[model samples]
Target: MPVPSQRYVRNHLLSILSPDDYEAIQSVAEGVALGRRDILIAANKSITHVYFLESGIGSEVAATPEGRRIEVCITGPEGIVGVPLLLDVDRTPHETFVQIEGDAVRVEATAFRRLIEERRLLRGIFAHYAYVAHLQTAGTALSNGSHTLEERLARWLLMCHDRVDGDEFPVTHEFLSTMLGVRRPGVTTAIHSLEGAGMIKARRSHVQVLDRDKLKAAAGDSYGVPETEYRRLLWARR
Candidate 1:
């Protein structure tokens, strides 16, 4: 395969591609815009395509029988949105949605799967990504169970900022409450705490990061280690 443009290679699994492997799959790719709150994949629905986000944030969430939603994981430029394709499954158990409007490169699932079989390096890279996702799930469990609302909110915002490539992104406190598995009031309080500390400036539908170090501190202890490991081990891997 020919080497793809550096831009595509800079996103998620593509970055891990050997030059030759990148060349092989580059031609089939197409880019798409993702709207805010758009459903990328529905729970139990057949996985038709996989997306590599060039911009924006995606949330992987599970809904309970009583209609409660909690974010289990997140995806951005550093990861693909559809994990079921990598796992050789047709449908995902959780729903994936666009958290912030952005664009992505998408390929049909069948093509992706066939391509993976012929590309050893891509397979290894994606396998490592799956492990990272597992780690994220574990981290979320710990954050929800042990961390304070303010800390969890900070961690979530920092993660979003890292993925979206900017300090400001479109997000509502109400939506954040759902992601944090807390009530809207809790989200409001946490937002105020971060804002008071000068870590972020919150508005109607956006929050701009001001002091990233302070935001990281507000995320507390547990969220930091695993997130740091994610950047070091999974994203930094060739």
Candidate 2:
């Protein structure tokens, strides 16, 4: 399989790697396309391969026996999906899936583990990302519990906006409700609220961000800590 060239690698964790380090990993990696609803990691199942997403969005979701699902974290090129591989763990309780269609460069779990073990920088980079994922989870909890529905929606959209390529993206009331752990009607109400405020434009199955700064103001303090920390820790090394 051809490894993505250094100039073409999109995964943030992979792109910032020193050339020699990048080559070390790329030599073992192969690119795979991921589609909407593709299950990347099933709960409690051994993760066989780890993906460094080249483009698109993935979600860390938790579910109940009653079938209620809520997204706890989101990742794109900025993050990696399989962290259990780095922690000496075989599986995780959370299920990860692609929220939007995209592609990734993946390597066997054991191979990745070995590479990171032999290289301290790779290990530290992933560890730092895990910390950032944690902070994102904390932010989600704060948003879900304390913020109003409209504010929560704004925060969620902002996070998605960070992951994709452009201002407009495909989304639906059903998807938003599932990710937000709310009823479809409630999600629709929030969407209208934001749209009316001119922060976004929502149509049948897509949303276009009209004013990101305004959206941030609506999300208040719920959206930036993890992002700021990502810049501080990851970009500093880059």
Candidate 3:
């Protein structure tokens, strides 16, 4: 485990922090490789650390005892994994896990809490970012309640596209089904619909964005609001 250097940073929130703020984080951070399905925060358990992704995507999933779960929030390289900890929470019913394999620099929960306590400005910055994260989750809830399957899928893919380094990403029907809280067959149908409209191209286990505007159109108003808020709240000054 090498120390995470501030020289290389892709997590947008971390990138925006002042030099001293970032240096404080580096003092407590260590680079880690994350694999798909790696649990960062288990439901009902005390959080051990907070992960700031340098690449790939993570998910905060809501689950029921009946064995149903849905991704309520998506954490890309632009976000952090342990958001509830910022609100002084140590545990939550929602589980946070890696949705795609990638790299991250994580800080132990105690050290990070101490850092925030000592640095008021950094805490303010994180609070604004936390609000942006909240907006994304709210957007997911709104889409799940009011959008069609195609619209929802389009929005999800667009979000993924934004996070990935390129237009193409590895995904499967089973994975998409789990994320969207839909059946495998329904995800297939939605993929075909997006392909038919020329917004995306899908093969056996991957999808590529062909036309971003078209995907946005397919998503209608269900997408972009949270993205807008993210930019306004987090990236406006930077």
Candidate 4:
């Protein structure tokens, strides 16, 4: 597969692919436009494709019998949407929905599986991604169970910023309410709390980080490798 210029431009995993492996898988990939609130994977269903985000964000959400849903993780360009495919797990553990409109590279599961079997470098990167995803899942569970809403919000913002590589992005309060599993008013309060603390400035659809260090402290022990792995893997000088 010849590497697409757009793919080689920004994808973390694609950047790490060995020359031949990158070329091998690149041809099978196709780009697609994703809109807000798109359901990429339904809960308990089989995930037949993996999405490599080029410029948007997706959330892994878990829903209960009472219709309560909470976001477990955020995936953007730094990661893929269909996590189970990497581990060869057919059924999805949770629902994946597009949170923002963006572009992504789609690879069918069958083709991706074949690529994984034949490419050692791709296999290793996905393995590391799986471990990091596991760590994120565990950390999110702990954060929800033990942390306050404000703490969780701070942690969520930091994670988003890390993945998007920016402090500001388009995100509405409604989405935050759903992601945090709280009411709109609760999200308002949390934003106000962070603003009052001089940690962030929340506008209509953007929350600017004014004091990242302070926000980091508010997040406490909730931050994990999913937020830091890029630096450790791609930016570190060997």
Candidate 5:
């Protein structure tokens, strides 16, 4: 019910906008609290609003008719939700939901569409973000297809850690399994392996990064390319 402070406006895409461009949309943007597992964009449904996360993580998931789900990409303050709207689409087959509780700045989809059309810089920022999202999705596909469970889990943890404010966050084996499209036992085993290697410490319903460098090593080449690309495209000038 209260207004979000300027400090809460940490979404990278929004932050990179020129001051004039940001102010143009600020009047229409409303802050909202997002709860864990909150559905932001439902598959096959028209998107009503687009969210620029101020904190926490969102998962873009792909589902099959058999009710199986696999995460295609993870977004946080570094990205935006409702990407299909940017591509001139009204709906998508992929669903997006909050993987952790956080806050976001939201704008009506129509307003957002209009704003981008009227502002070249804003439109360019969103275009860059969409390309980064594509790279992240591609990275996920490569990880899922080629990496080991432990390596993939490490990569996921590194991604989450980059988005959160601290070294630790709450996550369960079941949730990890669903995100990774692996069995629960496989997630458990991977968690233990990371913990044993001192790459992370797992507790009840949480995981903490102990040695990020080692974790990156465990993730091998699956973790850094998209991150480097994001920084190059979006954050370098800032």
Candidate 6:
């Protein structure tokens, strides 16, 4: 198969690869369209492929036996979806799915594993990304335990904004509640609070960031730690 042109590769993780490393796996990579709610990885299921998002967002979620699900981390173009593959695991305990409609570059799991084994830099990058992803998960846990609902909402909005293209993005109270592990009423109330504060504009199924600085202020110390760590670990290395 023909390799995709560099100009067409928007995924930050793929873009940062050295030319040789990028080409090493390029022939096996295929572009795919992702829909909202598309399951990329199902808990305990053997992963068939690994995805590098070109746009949109995905959520890593944990579920209870009762089927209650809550997002543990959000991934965008900056990261890959199949972390278990990098860790030499065939299945993951958590599920991952697209939160927004977008496109991705996907490669068969076997091909990806072969590339990782052959490329030292690619292996190092995946390891670094996995660490960054873990930090994000830890930050989410800490914020949920310590921060107020409004503050957590602010932090989530900021994270979403960083991944999306513009000030506005498609989201809903139900979705927000699911991601934050809160009730819908609580998310509704928090949205109103942020809207009243002029930090954001809430529409029927979307939220627009009006003032990111104010949003960060609302989030307090619950936000930025993981982001800073990402820049330090990945951007510096890049």
Q: Which candidate model has the greater lDDT, 1 or 3?
A: 3
lDDT of 3 by residue, 128-213 (tens): 87898898889999999999999999999999999999899999999889989999999999999999999999998889999999
Task: Please give, for residues 1-238, the per-residue lDDT of candidate 1 as tens digits.
Answer: 2323856455766766777776666767776888988998889889888888877888999999899999999999888888778888899779999988888878888889998888877787787777788888888999899989998898888888888775788889889889988999989988998899999999899899999998888887756665676677666665
- How close to the true structure is residue 34 of candidate 2, measured as C-alpha lDDT? 93
In TM-score terms, candidate 2 sits at 0.97
lDDT of each: 0.83, 0.91, 0.90, 0.81, 0.91, 0.91
Output the lDDT of residue 126, model 5: 89
Q: Which ranges of candidate 4 are over 4 A from the true structure? A: 1-3, 233-238
In model 1, pairs of residues that clash are 1-23, 1-24, 2-23
Q: Estimate each model's TM-score.
A: 0.92, 0.97, 0.97, 0.90, 0.97, 0.96
Better of 1 and 2 by lDDT: 2
Model 2, span 1-238: residue lDDT tens = 3668988888889988888889999889898999899999999899989889988999999999887889999999999989878888979888999988899999998899899889998889999999999999999998899999988999989999998999998899999999999999999888999999999999989999999999999999877999999999997876
Tens-place lDDT per residue, model 6, 65-139, is: 998888899999899999889999999989999998898889899999999999999899889999999988999
lDDT of 5 by residue, 98-204 (tens): 99999999999999989988888788888888999999999999999999999999999999999999899989999999999999998999899999999999999
How many angstroms is residue 4 displaced in model 3 relative to the true structure, after the best TM-score fit?
4.9
Show pairs that collide, candidate 5: none
Q: Model 4: per-residue lDDT, tens digit, 73-116?
A: 78887777787877788877589988867778788889999999
Candidate 1: where are CA atoms >4 Å away?
1-4, 7-10
**How many residue pairs collide in each prediction?**
3, 0, 0, 2, 0, 0
